[model samples]
Target: MVHVYGPHIFHTNDAEVWEYVNGFQRFMPYKNQVKTTSRGHVYSLPINLHTINQFFGKTFRPDEARAFLERQADKSITDPSTFEEQALSLVGRDLYEAFFKGYTEKQWGCSPTKLPASILKRLPVRFNYDDNYFFHKFQGMPENGYTDMVGQILDHPNIEVQLATKYRRSDRLDAIHIFYSGPIDGYFDYEDGRLGYRTLDFERFHFDGDYQGCAVMNYGDASAPYTRVTEHKHFSPWEEHQGSVCYREYSRACGPDDIPYYPIRLVEEKALLAHYVARAEREKGVTFVGRLGTYRYLDMDVTIREALDTARHYLPRAAARGHMPSFLEKAIAC
Candidate 1:
């Protein structure tokens, strides 16, 4: 049985997904404002110039901000081997501690020093006043909702969606080809060991008016139990409502029953993943796709792009080969 997750905020860099979503008539565009709560004050995320200026109480122009950050950056860390080291090298001690250290520890359920440097590499520090969370050229959400957009996408005559259906491995054992988007380790039934994952618990509540006055407000303080609170109404600013809904997100280690959100690819988890990959390589007539299938963290856009690429590669080759093609080329490489 497949249990699909609910409502997701789709943010992508892929032009195809961007164009496809834009084709929808009820699309709404809003500049992303991801704020962080640190030291009882809210600051713009991605460490933009405004955040730096506000945090340090200085009016720094672009060049001045760049120079100021350079001064804050630790020159001693010539080679960063961990996420903490990487943050210290890029931003410095104060900003790193206030914004990254506690939040990261809560999110991953581990010290930043134990995580990979690649985790922090994706975050960009801006020298300008731009507070947009993502710098993607095409950035927006559906005006109506993600549910409505997905319903529109699934309105095809050729496609059939069976909701509340539970799919089991035994049921598809004899199938010629199978495209699996579930956890790769789950496919093998966790023979080696269960791969680590960080899951989230969201506490939903209703507010009479604007609660945090933002779409996303992250709690950077380690003392804070929850990681972030997302105001749902702010996501669709085009629509007006008397009341607002928000979710306070708490990150925790994924249990057997919980839905996995972020893949925890620590040293031990990587070893476990390697074993699963080897097993998948030897398996026949099966291909793994998506973040969980490939055991990697992927954003909405990259996931869609990969899905399109996988289909493009498989459909053409499968017919000519007269057999199911191997797993996704990229997944196999990973």
Candidate 2:
């Protein structure tokens, strides 16, 4: 089966979360070794020691590389205000422009200068040769794929899986509580402007054999139309298929029918989100959850982690007949 929404990698530091998933599905050992095509050559991703050495033509020691980066970094910007400034300060101009600038503009459909510097805080810029993508203890893909895992999860008697069901805000519900994972704006019938989101268009094609030889290959140049190419077969290396399926991913502004992939969360969206969040707080019997619900980009682990926390939160309230808050500490973290 294909991951129609694109590759969902499981990586987390939370021990309980790791154990939680393992109980449902057998996870195969997998490490996402990402590569990026910049200019005429390909380089290792997350801009690590190997990437740095390859890009700059230097085999500097750890301390030497750190010192070199310090020199390259823009020391003038003591307090970075934007994503561009933050990246420039972290990896310096040449690396930032080559690896981040064009790619970021393509991904977000805006100048990084307009994005908050906090955006880059989660991004890892290592002085070591670690290219594992995520620096988490547990990282792997479900042996039978996510669809199967989800099917197993919903196997409980009380849960009835509903597809092709449009959830109308006006619909009268009989449920004691609600956990909404749809777009926050849609929940309120878009009284405020629809929050900006980045949706993906995939150019899916089949290849007889290996395609990119890797799971994900990023295109860093603005000249390229798409952000990355994902070869699905490589994701589950434990099993082998002679054939391959690939997707050249293109990101654009989300529309009414399009699935919201990445929330923009720019100045305009943030203001609208603030209003929607305020409305959600006042909303009864509902708790906004997940990426779309919270209007933020979140990994699968974070989303699941929050969902677990939400359940734990709702249990006590359910027993005591108390009010369950709209946003908990975990939800707020999203």
Best by lDDT: 2
lDDT of each: 0.82, 0.88
Runs of candidate 1 with Cα error greater than 4 angstroms are 1-9, 23-25, 322-325, 329-334
Model 1 TM-score, all chains together: 0.93
lDDT measured at residue 219 in model 2 versus the true structure, 0 to 100: 97
The candidate maximizing TM-score is 2
Residue 98 local lDDT, model 2: 90
Query: What tens-digit string does per-residue lDDT give for candidate 1 at 181-296?
Result: 88988887877889999898888888998898988899999999999888877777777877878788888999999998979899888888888887887877777888888988
Clashes of each: 2, 0
Worst 10 residues of 1 by lDDT: 1-10
Stretches of candidate 2 above 4 Å error? 329-334
